[model samples]
Target: MTSFMEDYFRTALSKELAIAPPERDHEHLSSTSRLLEKQREVTEAETLLANQKE
Candidate 1:
């Protein structure tokens, strides 16, 4: 590869890594999962109710 291409890739990668946030901790991940599950359950219940009216 040319020097320009290598420099471009390195700069782009560094910028992307810098812009991205760190990974969440275990507890945070579980909390998010629980909230998402609850949201799904609520959506399912709402859909059932809506369908029953049909």
Candidate 2:
């Protein structure tokens, strides 16, 4: 009985969480690219600021 309940709960939980559109690869790549671009910009600004202070 416990095994049966475990299987039932597992199935229900899986179904409840199986709720994504699965287009995450493309979305994630774009998000990563945007973040990397922003990081590069910030690094450039920091270098310029240090150069001016020196």
TM-score of 1: 0.46
lDDT of 2 by residue, 1-54 (tens): 997898688668866875443333445578777687668669867965774574
Backbone clashes in candidate 1 total 0
- Which runs in model 2 stand beyond 4 Å of their true positions? 1-29
Candidates' C-alpha lDDT: 0.66, 0.67
lDDT of 1 by residue, 1-54 (tens): 687797688668755765333444547567777687668669867965774574
Candidate 1 global lDDT: 0.66
The pairs that clash in candidate 1 are none
Best by TM-score: 2
TM values, all candidates = 0.46, 0.47
